[model samples]
Target: MTSTAAPDRPATQPRAPRRRALAERLLDTPLADALAGPHTVDHYLEILRPDWAVKRVRGEILDVRHQNEDSVTLTLRPTVTWPGFQAGQHVELSVDVDGVRHRRCYSPSGSADHRTRTVELTIRVHPQGVVSRHLKAHARRGMFVGLSLPRGEEFVLPTPRPRRVVLISGGSGITPVLSMLRTLTDEGHRGEIVFLHYVRGPRELLHADDLAAIEAAHDNVTVLRVATREAGELPTGWLSGRFGPEHLRRALPEDADAAAFVCGPGALVESVREAFREGGLTTPLRYEHFAPPELPEMDPDQLGTVTFAASDQQVEGDGRPLLEQAEAAGLRPEHGCRMGICMSCKCRLQHGQVRDTLTGEIHGTPGAEIRICVAAAVGDVTVEL
Candidate 1:
């Protein structure tokens, strides 16, 4: 049989070997033994280009714009080490402030299915947030920051796609859900999407223009802008106040089988969850929290001494997280997020018991790892830090 190549098909080029192959080949040479190591090489490469590293994933800021008075959005071009992310995933971004490195978790506010090599992060600049304030005040195009691979799979869209989706977010929590909405729209999703976002006022809304455009362009998408503070200022069709059962009823049809996703403050998430439960809705309800869960009140007398096994230091616990106690005692253990979500402050429980501040459960398994950010000493405790 004879066949002719299609005119629309372009000629393909052979794929080149990846950086790992090149590194392996270089390391096999005798010159590899003469250098200090990969660390020295990485140091030299970083001197030439901030994003150039053997294994570390770094992103260079390509654009920075203030979304509003309290928020800034950054467009980043990550190094090839980045593996990309799902629509609803977040990354641990690390940046240097003064002389100390601070890390925080942030979700990308862009379409995951978009044909681009960049990601966008919309950060709300809290008055006490070190990283957020630094990025807002000092971040410039071409500056580099460290990035962890994408994390969190709980809030991603369902694989087969549901017939209807309900997205609820408040304030800065719109980031991940916005990513999901953008991805679904880019994929030409046919399902009905009801997006309800709550903000203090119009001035606090992020990506207001994009949301308006998306709602106008897509017939299947319904966008509701709710103003909690300036309720009287909202438009006729806009919503007023926070989320409640009535809002849920307004968003979802009585007989509709819809999957719900919520990302926002603890109160908003809890209210959504409670509404779902009260309404007897069986469809999936997934949520994400940016802050640490509220801990139950603890008695100061119940808190005991904490011993750092490796550091050979001890400190009297102050009814706070072990990580805070460690910091107060002049020990700098590696940590990220400081909210127990990143798992970067996990340490071994050498002895004694600790209480999970989030769940109020006590754990005493020897040698088991515990997240120091959310684990408090039940009594006298020993930890491998």
Candidate 2:
């Protein structure tokens, strides 16, 4: 008694035409075409990427040097750079821990010897730090990680500012300040500059030899380190421990008015900025907000579906960040400092609006978007990924 037609075949459903890739969209959308041009396709391809999908080995770990009990220096093999970085710039290290994608932005512990393409990172291990712990415990030679080209404008020397410059850093925040000092000295870039760094003890210091060599070679460059555990007079030998607005002022040249660069954690950076302002510093002040520890307080469970888009990819992080989940899924997006301070991970927003933690602006780029790190889904959404 079976029907000859096989009991009515399921109605055939037609597959909707595939939407164009972001590169194709740029070519099709005249507005975006004019803005980004034929180069837009390349730009889209370059920016819209999954961390694992497009990430390639830039270099292998050359060697590991221990700074003290909890600090280590990793020397990387040769890397490639395009559009040479300015005197003061930074690089983003893309790493993975137990299948979870994590990115950390570390300032060069070495100099701008691009020929070698080798950079060193002085990492102080935090008990709860993700990347630091993983690298300190497991990373080894020949292990490869993705690194975004060097970036950051906040560290650049100002042309209109006074010749005298004062650099301030605390704890393990001396990385970028070290880069700036080395660049200036290595290139004979002149102007009186003094670096004031604060640390817990001398043993935890980074690049002691390099810093000393710079100070000795350059008459205009001075290095002052405040090691709290130094049981002696104020920084008599290679290091010392004293840092604050008072110390900063004392270290400056006769020209009290000079550009001041600062780096470190949020509270430290804010405190230094306030102190500098209170001192009536008219010179251009710049700062780099170091990578922050993951906030366990962020409860993605409370959120609804979050949608996001990029050039060549699309992503959804359920109620969380598309970038994070996408990274977990092995998509490598170009990002510098994931704190949303550097904006290197900016992406296109094709669908739902998002609220940015840094700016608190509701964003839906239509075909554009905001940085992925500090943004959250406001509602059900779709993105170019």
Candidate 3:
């Protein structure tokens, strides 16, 4: 006869505490980010945590797509703590290579879709770019990386979406502009848009498929391509005729309140700015630069000494960036982008003058925040970092 009473419950396992389980699942354990000191816990256990939860904002490479011959687009999945970014904004990505964290800034190339908990960054490998090279060569699906909150103000979607918009992009500078266009398409922006991309050849055209898709889907979208190499008539220095006042006038909507965003190499951005000015298009203009503009010739003899007060290190400064100097002295200082765009290497100038390596501007005011990645000490200096 079968026993009516419940048989011995088959070795049921005890359930973990709700709060503890949640904390572990989210990688929100306290003191997890601290690198040293006895107060830190679970520092060694980080390998077991989900990539997105291990730091302030961690992300894992969900997918990678080769957009063209020289560029690759990476899809990243970040944790919930990542402050949602606006289209045309950039974030700092830190990848650990051989136990060293190398950081760089990249604009998201995907739509600002927070609901999907995903973003994309398209990167082109620079000759001396360590992070870009590694990401292109080795970073693959499921690789965990560190990230900073989105930071950038010069290129964001303007409120009330202007009646007309023109997007000018050069080479790989299309990354952020692509994001803005995708977002506008998703939001059903009713404004007329003129997008002009300048590339050396059709193979060099980044996001050609996406641009074609946007043009096919939206009636108000007009996509134009200016292949500089193909247009041999243009001067060797700048692609002036391809995107000048005449071109703008012909391409942009007439007599409509318009806003223009220019992104790309320094020459392209500057050329577009001049075109806008010459055309007398008194509309809002925004720009983002992938590289520093041509700086005035710096004096080779003008060098300084940099004293790291906290690290108790002193090093002779060269015309190179302070970040590079500090590294040469065997002191590891936090930095990103090395281009001064991300503002990740910002530090206080305790006492001395520093020169902006990009714009050739001087900052003698002590106690001001300076980006060490692009600022060189002008004379004897002391830094708080």
Candidate 4:
């Protein structure tokens, strides 16, 4: 698992020759970003498979691109088909290494409509892992890649209009929230929506203008950002002092039975859910999570027992992967965001058990398991999520 927010490596290491410095910059005041200036389809395609027609490339590097070196915006391209997306859904990507495949999930940036031909991804990359590393290293345009059906309903649209919609997201976990935010506007959203998002630096914020534009276009829309790392960073339009239950309540309108879409770190989601519950805002708060609940790490020795539900077959492996192990045993499972964010391959445990390597907890739900992309196996576990 563990994919979100890449660490800064020493500049001494090898890096692609970038026209820009590729560093984070602050938004003292809203400033126009050059990266967002303009780019063509050909420009992005040549980023990997030089031959635009030959979109199949193995080492396509979809590096975590920001609006600028210091901007907070992150961008990516979706690798699937169309209508392209009607807003508020996810796409699963398959990362194959040495014939072993891993599923990684990402919320499409938005619908690939008649206006825009490319689907964008606004993700904070994780330094380690299969897809993240590959994307950070070789996700170039024009490279043919495997993708899954778009999935998820976290950002359900409100009918005709709503009092408002409040979006709460933390860290690089702003993907789904952004999609919903833009959806409201692009679809000629007539209702009001408030966005309370968290990012460490203003420079790292994703889609600055998009959010600003939404706020500007509609008198009903309000955009607020929080920077946890800054002390005197007084962002002009911040809603809460920090992100949490308290911040959410303060950010939304009082009488507004606003639709709420929440995304980000699992801990933040749990906390916000509990916080909102306490606040009596029980309107089924929509949430998106890319990771299983964080728990203690499990021992590798215990990660070799799993019984597939479809095949009625039991399999054991060397802490390799639940999806991989399943596939090796002739079971093809659906997956994306193999690191855990996508939630594409989540299944329920019909019987038996499983243990997560990164997060130590043995699955809690006996019937409903977890995203298979993130778990291995343990004690002849049976999976049904």
Candidate 5:
């Protein structure tokens, strides 16, 4: 005979009903009505406790560390309501710059340790990126910012983990891979790990000290770094040029069953994919890129029309992203991670065909959900926004 035991709830779970009753009673008071006449509960809460309580998923900047001239890492203490995250997932971060709110997605470059009540994000300031520039230059401790729950499943390790793994990353793509490495090291993973990373030069290296520590502490770990901008002094048989087929072939582990994870720019990711396909190294390969893969130039005849059913308006699809088109047409749709990662701009396609700008694949199924940040219309289409 088998006995099944019920699960135990947290100590705070039992207090929720009591809290709800208290809240109801408090709202019945005349002061509550006076507060509600012109403002919302969030406004009153902000007035009572400005820095801690927020209507959205919020976090306070606890510390900042500069990893390189172009990048900085921020340690954030998130609200208690934040559901925990996996190692390689990303979160949408929102900051207000010059009275305009801008949001972007960034993967935390550290372990998801809930006990510490903190997560870290490493961001590179792009040339023309306003929010990135603000974060790198003016962001300081005690500043509160909005955060989304962890997202993305494409570049993560599989369950029942592989005995041997190869991780490849280029430039800022090292962020998510760093999270995976931190998680593995913390959990005492004894499997063989070969990490190959590429950067412009030594100055641009991300998480250098951490990688060095990992290599020194674990006998099963190996680190190979390549520099693209280094001048005439090459180590014997080491890579010097930009990442290419030769470099990838040298970095691939000898084990045929090893899983491979790659992240980088679209060109780098595609190049690695092609190299893997040609080399017959078919152990499960996963790759992610911030930008869409390059597609052939859109012909003038390929342009289609997009209609918004709710607005009774239409616009010509110029082969750009649907989000850009919608914004140009004066529709302020909720969106985050404009790189097609967060899926915040997803909407139902009521009719006609749409092409994915990333893979150049056409999707036309009725009532299909489409990510507007990366999809473009192929013909006359209607989207329920």
Candidate 6:
């Protein structure tokens, strides 16, 4: 005999806003705590709704836009608990796929001056990207995902806006700098602004119409769109070929002091840095890398043993990242943005030393936190996992 029963309603179902507010208030009161003695209020609230939490920040997908075959834009409505983000900061977004939670860092593309709690994230789907592909294929309105508070400080607008500003980006790297541009225009900035964006072709350009509108509305702005792979005659305001020193000269006036912000691929960032160096410009060139910088080959003789102190697991270092070695040893550790950007895989170095893969710097401080994703074992090392 089989029992026939109705399944619980999906947590994605919308709840009355006032009711949720009352419940949240009640949960915060001393009476609810006394009634639920010694148990977490979140555990019970989670049974009522998936997105409800006492301290964790979560957002519901409010809209999804397919920008192209390989990219998507998701608009999210974060819970009231969310701390607002700066124009150029990033957040760690987490989603569950096949019973495993995966997290990635993404910069919001929307203006920070908007009078709303919604955030926009434009994601490029890499061929091997798990979260990006999952979002492109399955993300929809009402889906809930975990979110971290805004987390970057370097790639932001200066306190006193420069008289002249140059913003450069390539591929999907346009998101953050686009946010900066939107914020500047929204604030009615009177400074001269030059925006340069590079893509494979016009079809791959993100926010082309919006960018054109911005340029048209603001006399102080100049927008340059470059299609690196296009051939033949190009239209006005559009150029063909990859970024080079010529493009740099076109974007910036000789001897003109301008603040610069760049975000893109490693090679593109390097090229821009080199261009600045070659030009002998003293202007600050701030940049953010979309991927981890390439690491040099590690000497095999320097490899040693890596010990997970908490798990009591040891593996012979193979000149690979500690995160990879721990995973090979059948230990599951929390990690996000394996590129070392999110700091999700950070662990305390309990004993011994480890080498930073990106900078080749060695660290051996006891109780020092290190990002395991980009750290390789220097010798017999122990880390609190």
Candidate achieving the largest lDDT: 6
lDDT of 3 by residue, 1-385 (tens): 8884455543333344666567655545444444435633334444556552433677888998887655778999886567789989999988878887788899998998555479899999888888888888887898877778999887898888888988888888888888888888888898888888888866687877788899999999988777777644633322333567666775575746888888888888888788777777788789987776676655756677789989989988777788988888888888777778888788999999888876688886778899998888887889987
The CA lDDT at 102 in model 6 is 89
Candidate 5 Cα errors over 4 Å, as ranges? 1-47, 50-56, 113-116, 229-238
Stretches off by above 4 angstroms in model 1 are 1-40, 51-54, 254-257
What lDDT does each candidate get?
Answer: 0.85, 0.66, 0.79, 0.61, 0.80, 0.85
State the local distance difference test value for candidate 4.
0.61
Ranking by lDDT: 6, 1, 5, 3, 2, 4
Q: What is the TM-score of each candidate against the true structure?
A: 0.87, 0.62, 0.81, 0.63, 0.82, 0.84
Better of 3 and 6 by lDDT: 6
Q: Which window of ten consecutive residues has the lowest lDDT sum in model 3? A: 232-241
- Alpha-carbon RMSD of each model: 4.5, 17.7, 5.9, 16.7, 7.4, 9.1
For model 2, how does the per-residue alpha-carbon lDDT over 331-367 read when each residue is reduced to its tens digit? 7777656677667787877676776554456667576
Better of 2 and 3 by lDDT: 3
How would you encode candidate 5's per-residue C-alpha lDDT over 96-121 as one tens digit per residue? 89898888899888886444468889
Writing each residue's lDDT as its tens digit, candidate 4 over 18-53 gives 412232122111242334337433335446434331
Compared with the true structure, what per-residue lDDT tens digits does model 1 show for residues 1-385? Answer: 8566774354542234456568746744546545846545545666887876655688999999997778889999998778888988889999988899888889899888857589999998989888999999998999998899998877798888888988899988899999999989989999999999998888788999999999999999999899988945576677888888779887787536678899888778888888989888887999987554576777776788899999999998777889989988999898876766778898999988888876678888889999998889988999998
Candidate 6 Cα deviation (angstroms), residue 382: 2.8
How big is the positional error of residue 141 in model 6, measured in Å on the Cα after superposition? 1.6
Say which candidate scores most in TM-score: 1
The lDDT, on a scale of 0 to 1, for candidate 2 is 0.66
Alpha carbon deviation, residue 334, candidate 6 (Å): 1.1
Q: 1 or 3, which is superior by TM-score? A: 1
